[model samples]
Target chain A: MVADSLVAVTIRSLVLIIVLLTVFAYLMLFERKFLGWFHLRLGPNRTGPWGLAQPIADGVKMIFKEDIIPRDADRFIFKLAPVISLFVAFAAFAVIPVGPPLKIGNWTVPLSIADPNAGVLVLLAFTSLGVYGIALGGWASQSKYSLLGALRSTAQMISYELTMGMSLVGVILLAGSLRLSDIVTAQESLWFIVRQPVGFILFFISVVAEVNRVPFDLPEAETELVAGYHTEYSGMRFAMFAIAEYVNMITVSSLVTLLYLGGWRGPAFLPPVVWFLLKVSFFVFLFIWMRATLPRLRYDRLMAFGWKVMLPVAFLNLVATAAWVAFR
Target chain B: MATRSPEYFTHQGYEVLETLDGDRMILSVGPHHPSTHGVLRLILELEGETVVRCTPEIGFLHTGIEKTAENLTWQQAITVIDRMDYLSPLSNNLGYVLAVEKLLGLEVPPRAVTVRLLLAELMRIASHLVWLGTTGLDLGVQSMIMYAFDLREGILDMFEEVSGARMNPSYFRVGGLAADLTPEFERMLRDWLQRFPKRYEELRALMEENPIFLDRVRGVGAISQEDAIAWGLTGPNLRATGVSYDVRKAFPYMGYETYDFEVPVGTAGDTYDRYMVRVLEMWESYKLVQQALERLPDGPWQTDDRKIVRPPKHEVRESMEQLIHHFKIVSYGFDVPAGEVYVPIESPRGEFGVYLVSNGTNKPWRVRVRPPSFYNVMAIPKMLEGNLIADLVSVVATVDPVFGEVDR
Candidate 1:
């Protein structure tokens, strides 16, 4: 009951958003540094000591830059699109449990902003809503490059969203609950990655595609589409789209931790939150590694791979998991 | 503007831009784009993502290099020539110097010829490294450029030691080299040679071993051998289509015939083949450098004729006759015979030819360049037929059109 209190919810949300945004900012720095290491170059060391203050410098710079809406753009939608993107990205974290509920004296505080029975569904729905932000932003910008990018993003996200949901069905069936906490709890003995390895791989690929990360980052393929969906965006508005992207990466990494990895369950030496952070950081590092290693998939080939390979495999995994659960 | 008739749209060549008629999207793909290489624009008409019509528009980087060369003395014209193919300045210098040398009926010493051969091959490797790096970037392997540029820095360091400049060295003179290679140049070249093969292997494996890279490049932006020849494509672009028409083999300049190296050709004219041809070409260039370095003889680097070669600084200060020769060469430049000569050489891009017209005057009557990239770029529309917009980036990158050469 204390967990569901409105005051508790508001305080938790305010804390979560601020923490998430800060994490998002620092994660950008981490990616740049890590990618720089991969590139055999020192990245972003000029801003502060070892570039620790780079994200803050970048934030201040973005805030000061001029925000220009193109003369031919749909002004209202162009202004509204990044807001939609940032909102959807942050909103997905509400139902994603970071660690077990905190107990302070007689008061119990849920770590997540909200705890719904169908938390995984809520997260999926929020992520699916992210396509609207990209689609509308591209269409409203009045630029051909943006429109093509938007179109590619629309098709890509829609195709991969199905496989993503289907992959999660195996985890949902194994846990016999839609609550993310329950899914994490079910993995107390054995992580789902051991049982549903195929589903985990499928989820990983689809998540990469869903977030429009490289190999699947056609929506913002800089060389091809010239900055893609954000071709016309500038200043703080452009920063919002970028911030939304990093936040989405964090959110998805957390989801993967909660579902496939053992969430906050680790050795008793460290705290549960630290274990959760470690797990999520591993996925983030993996994503960056993928970005450094791979080339962008062709648009047609991506679609074909999604339909012909990923969808069928994910569907079979779901059916087999359902049958296994029934037999057990 | 919205009320314009269909006939008006067709009349103004805005047929593809007519939004009301059909769903063709016209994308102006450069002059300011990241992947256009530099100031090259492609007016691409798209039905969905496929390029329906691609009209390449150039001259954005036209610096009037040919006309500018006409104003300079024959020997001084090498500066502007170096700017044409900015990626391979030494190759341009070689082409122009060889052309002017032919016009003067002057002979360069054997040592200068060997040094010129060595520098040319090193430059070929450097130019191909840029092509490979940029193609990697366009295809979405972002780290490849960093690896490539890191390796290329060693070559540029060697150039700086030899000529006191990096990109456009203008090291070649009409009769010989501006100066002999420094001992430091040889040390750096040996150091680079030691490290280049391992890094090159890494780069090649990074591209060829990845399945996604293969999928993106294989069978994309393909042109037939006939089409390649018809469009006047040369260098790696032509070699990728299974043609073995390297000018180094057909017409040896700077004793290219003496170098023991193979010309690598590809069977498929797709982006991958173009990529592989250039990758192998870099290795062959490496071999040529090694051979030239081994056979480098010790002798004079310029012609003994004071009428063409500048007299030594000490000799000019001491001897009155040498002073006049140096003064005339420095101030007015030596005059060439009233005849024209066209000399072609195997530049990294292709057959970089120089056509020079001397009018028995201090300045050349005409200085024309046959830049290889102009012909290579002409085949872009042919290569891009029925390919997607993403393929356009890869094709343009693999084609390696330096707009400085295309527009000059």
Candidate 2:
């Protein structure tokens, strides 16, 4: 009976994984379409009605693309890097609660794949591992730009990761729980964004830097470092890196919604999943809006900001939150 | 033996030369770089990250525009200027036409003057948007490009309403505008003017105080005011160095004096100062456009000179004389007196001057353009020396030289 239950749990987890991956693929298309609207241009409407098939086309193209490894590159590390990046990025979703539990006939299943007591810690570990892929990819390429980019990625990730981790301490303290679902429940009265605007801002900026998005994207500053760490990467291997980045964008956005905006909490009419998706979409749109509006920061400035500005702000927020929890 | 103690190396035909190991390294930046602002090449010698020497190689976008101008008549030459600094073609058109208008000795009506001022300011904002976006992109800010382009589209729409094209409007004729401003165009302009300042503030919030942006730009590519004047750098690039020199203020043309606006000057003349100057200038341009719109006088859009301008469209249908004049002007074009005139207009890049020798013919004998970007680009080497490889983009973006103008 125990073996049967274990098999059933594994099967249910596999189903959830498949569903999330499908959502991730469509989310990319959704971003492209929305960003296009924001820019007053049509994005991708050719493949199907409103470009529904565009992502599929992209996937097929990526699959058929010629995979090339640089001659002087460390073959083993280069091959392993993208896989590690993609695995870690996708694996983080397992801890995120997409919606409330659903019951059908005799079976009841949670929206998330797993709900561990240390869910937040597991997500952080996965994110930390993602940087290893970037560092390894840069080091393995053995090119100057790539090396510089990898070095930047290492420094940026280490610096911003601290702030990112620290910023979340406030959320953890408020919820008094590490599980994402439990945190969402705690936010039923009011969202963390209202109480901790500074932390939210810090978290948002650090994540943007961590993902190497615009303004903080020194690791892949195209004009200066010529694609930075990924200068030599090509074909589907490059596509995997690209996909992982978009996935991380989605993951971070979802996390922001859950932590600050009050996860899956909206007016009575909409379903819980719909509210979750709506909040996630809002954050995703913000990311695109920011990418389209601001200029990139210089490498020194980016490093300085991560160390000096974001770190201090995050620490202050953490202290304030701990004090508030104690006093309350 | 008589070789007398074998004289030192110098007397033995071996010359001693001094070598400095720490001399600046030579690096060629680009002909196809992302931040050269469109196909500009800069040869840089660096003492580590500081630029020791800079040499700008242009002519990539040169289509022999000056030579091409000589073949075309006064009116046809306007099209040629449109190709130079394609970002602010209206200003180019205004400069060329104003030069020809001076030769013809025609007075543009009040409406024409107002329209010219309005469009010129709009073009300045549009051009600066391109600068802001591309510069931001060069500095690794991907979103600034989108914001720049978004603002630019509204201005382009206004241009298209008046001139029927987004780029290369060629709307400004010799004595006046090609067409009157439509009612819809005016509404769009008023709406945009109101919204632009707020949007600019939003953009500033995103970038200006962000410590990273400040550090990258503040002290990089600093040029002294004396060196800037000596180098013949004009426009915002020159003004960034604390010089209060502006062609519009010093030598007013297109009735720029009538507008109430201030020329923003910077103290440091560094990359950051140049950026601040441009951003501040956009607001000034916004104010100018608003003033021009409010005080715009109603009158004939084009100059009333039958000898120069073609007769009205209504008269052409009935009067044989009008028909003949129109046919002659379109087919052979009008002639100017045998003399040379140099007319300069304040373009977004800088002072765009047109020197034309008419030779009492339909086509000019020789036409030359004093392009501002050419001079500005020459200052790159001086700017880059002793700066880091990363600071190269900052310097390039701050200069804001459009290759079309430089090459032309």
Best by TM-score: 1
Q: Once superposed on the true structure, which residue ranges of model 2 sit more than 4 Å away at CA?
A: A1-13, A37-47, A66-78, A91-125, A139-145, A162-205, A250-295, A309-328, B1-34, B42-55, B104-114, B133-151, B175-220, B290-307, B312-328, B386-391
DockQ of 2: 0.27
What is the C-alpha lDDT profile of model 1 across B128-171, one tens digit per residue?
99988898888899899989999999999999999999999999
- Over B94-118, each residue of candidate 2 has an lDDT whose tens digit, in order, gives 8888888888888999899889988
Q: Cα lDDT of all candidates, in order?
A: 0.91, 0.83
Clashes of each: 0, 17
- In angstroms, the error of model 2 at B149 is 4.2
Distance from true location, Cα of A317 in model 1, Å: 1.0
Worst 10 residues of 2 chain A by lDDT: A1-10
Give model 2 RMSD, 1 decimal. 7.5
